[model samples]
Target chain A: MIRIDQLIKRYGALMAINGIDLHVPAGELFAYLGPNGAGKTTTIRILTGLTKLSSGRAALNGHDIEKETLAAKRQCGLVPQNINLDSELTVSENLDIHGRLFCMKPVARKAKINELLTYVDLHERSKSLVKQLSGGMKRRVMVARALMHSPRILFLDEPTVGLDPNIRRRIWSLIKKIQQDGTTIFLTTHYIEEAEFLADRVAFLDKGRIVAMDSPIKLIAGLGNWAIDWLTDDGMQTAYFPSRTAARESATAKENGFTLRRVNLEDAFLSLTGKKVQ
Target chain B: MMHGIIAVYLREMLILKRRLKRQLSGMAISPLLYLIAFGYAMGDAVQFNGHTYLEFLIPGLVAMGSMTQSFSIASDINVARFYWCIFEEFQAAPISNFAYVTGEVLSGMTRALLAIIVILALGLPFGVVLYYGPLFWLAAILNSFVFASLAVALAMLVKSHADQSLLTNFVITPMAFLGGTFFPVDRLPMWAQKILFLLPLTHASKAIRAVALSEIPDWRAYLVLPVTGVLIFIFALRSVKHARD
Candidate 1:
């Protein structure tokens, strides 16, 4: 559903998104994991037509982002990191404006707004001003607003950032449901667990480059099935083992405080990038 | 593209409607004060182009109202860009830069028209009525267009809300005063006239006042406004494209 080839984006002397290639197949939930300033959002911005690429080519469902901007844009929906809904406008009005921008007919717009509001569990608050809603409610409204036109690909840039764990789980379910409905999702997140639970494939991006890309289970399995962490003079040292028995054996041999646990997606990301997801 | 422009324009209209009472209060107070302080205080002592001072002042106020209100859109754009982040939402959509600029410029012109109506209505209570013929409407629209387009371009260029306010203080406020809105440009010293003559509002006020008084306006003003509006509108499109990228 999305193709990026040798994409390069520069801001004066600094390259925000350097030569990166990616392919997101239709109906796949792809999570992009990175720390702060890791070019994740920049890549999403370039794909969604929010920022122009300095070099190379990107396409959405076969439409080139630069030459066929409108066509490419029409195929994608982006829920930005920040809540960009018009605060003074009602929830219905916000969705209505988005629908109208995409040239949805009035009857179609009304129906879609109702359906999306319901889909996001925001039907009751449709009449309320966006500013009156809670953070989670506002985020839901943002999601509904982005889906008003029903684009083929959805770009979610930290859709659950700053939300509580419960709310994050709700958003994750909503994202899962969106993917199940045959929409390709390209999600950028700092939450490794979120990616692990939701993404079919995860890519670790650091310093404007992708260091690792694979299924979360595969990536974690490739590192090890289990890990042992122990205090050391340097700081903290961790060793990975293929099984819990081996990890337990390693932990028993240690003479300091140690922890034995299953290897997770975060460990895979850290092993590749050497930087923890923040 | 048209749908996107209309959508954006409608959003602004809805906001304006909801804020009508506050907006009308703000729009009415200044023109009322101008009428009281300048019109009543002068008391027919100041005459221009063979008309009463109140008659002369009303059209100038209309011209100035359109200029200020239209240019005021920059503040709204700055708010949306920095505070609301709504501009980025549009950028991520299928809307074109030209469509976005057109929508904003139309909204600014609409605000200018509403301000003109408020000023004209205020003039009625003071027993000042003037011709609002085709020329008057044309000049008002073109005047609004020029300032609205300029506002869009400047809004894109400014980095912060503080910078936006600074621009209004240094650029817009001076033009509001010296754009032949209150007096004839020729009445100023030759050097001042040369400087003020370069402003689009000078031509707008001259043209609007001519129509209000039923005199044949200088054809040069009629040419200057539409030409300036078109050019500034193109520049505004470029600014929107640059800012979005």
Candidate 2:
């Protein structure tokens, strides 16, 4: 569980994270959707205690991140946005160090490392050096390393950023399995489909503010069931319709080529903020 | 806190163990060259303070080697910070700033101790045996502590890995050459001696060389090393906190 109240983070003249509030109940997979520099990473950084908050309060489970830093940090595991695994270290060694940092007992650390390696489908590659592994494998190792402490919550910041579609799907399944196993996941990503497919609830953050927050299906439903996309002189445009027949009729009225598709989480975000998630 | 320190130290030791062969060679090369070039070239031809030039140079080389090796921890820290992003993993973990700093400082000291061992072993072939008493080791450790702590503090402050190199060039290099490592600080002009005396390495060189040469070591040199080490250690802790900000 996580709680944030009127959280504001300012970097000199720039408002990296404007006033925002959020609460994620235990075992919920919450996706924070935003474009580049939308304060998604900033919010995650604040919550993880990597960066100090300029104002307001944030707590992990019940521990205040500022006042109870070690306790709050112990409550959550973060898979950072980048591939930060130690390249020179083996997969098992990396996980072993994380366990030690969290003060896990040697036997418990070894057992957890074994369990997580299997959980992430990396047991076979546990002896491999991180640098020797492929991108997807490295990402899996990072996931396993983060989970070594058995933290109550996991903060995944763009976990599948550079992976191919197939690998992304695999990571998505792993994420789904994690949520099913009762770990609360706080994910920040720019990929609309990732949020739609994996998150139990979604928050669309724009310019350091949350413009929309709801379940993916409900957010998409708010924009209707069907979407008609067509290229115009200005740029690409889209319109939503409650029925496929209505969407087809709208597409037929367009002179240029058009696409008729189901309304997705992106349409909802665009409709609310007038900006693309990418 | 102890667990955090051990965890951090263990990571460094693991890496060091993995690269022990190459690191051993690296630790040997510079001192080997100094011994052959300066030690053999001036073997018994020169004497300083009632000892052969080789005898004088071995302890000086030990002091310089320990200082350089201890300070080299910064480069490793910078690499973890910039390339590997391993430092961020520590930042996100439950480890306190004090624990992190202490762990890194100990690792640096470990490297320094290893380098000292290599230098002492290298000295054996030349029949250059000297006193390696507890006091000698205390001076060595205190000297390593000062530089290693300084290294951690500077590692946090530098913006890039390149900046870390610049710091070595400006800070460590000068201290290595002028800190009574090559010759007696007393032999230098009064003004130069005064300035070099300000260097912790200079006191370390004096204390270590005195003990190795079977003389009564100056108590002042022992006092300076730990006092400077503690101050730099506090600076390192504050730097880690500032880095998080």
* Top-TM-score structure, candidate number: 2
Task: Name the docking class for model 2.
Answer: high
lDDT of 1 by residue, B57-110 (tens): 888899999999999999999999999899988898788888899999999999
Model 1, A1-278: lDDT tens per residue?
89999999999999888899999999999999999899999999999888989999999999999999999999999999988999999999999999988999999999999899999998999999988999999999998988999999999999999999999999999999999999999999999889999999999998888888999989898888999999988988989999999889879977887998889988988888786888
| Residue pairs that clash (backbone atoms under 3 angstroms), model 2 | none
Worst 10 residues of 2 chain A by lDDT: A248-257
True contacts kept of each: 0.84, 0.87
User: Which RMSD does model 1 reach against the true structure?
Assistant: 1.4
DockQ of each: 0.82, 0.87
Could you give me the TM-score of model 2 versus the true structure? 0.99
Q: What tens-digit string does per-residue lDDT give for candidate 2 at B65-184?
A: 999999999999999998888899999999989999999999999999999999999999999879989899999999999999999999999999999999999999999999988888
Question: In model 1, where do residues sit more than 4 Å from their true spots?
Answer: A253-256
lDDT of 1: 0.91
What residue pairs are clashing in model 1? none
Please give, as one word, the docking class of candidate 1: high
Q: Please provide, for model 2 over A1-278, each residue's C-alpha lDDT reduced to its tens digit, 9 standing for 90 to 100.
A: 89999999999999988889999999999999999999999999999988999999999999999999999999999999889988888999999999999999999988998899999988998898888999999988888888888889999999999899999999999999988988999999999889989999999999999999999999998889998889998989888999999899778888988999999988998889988899
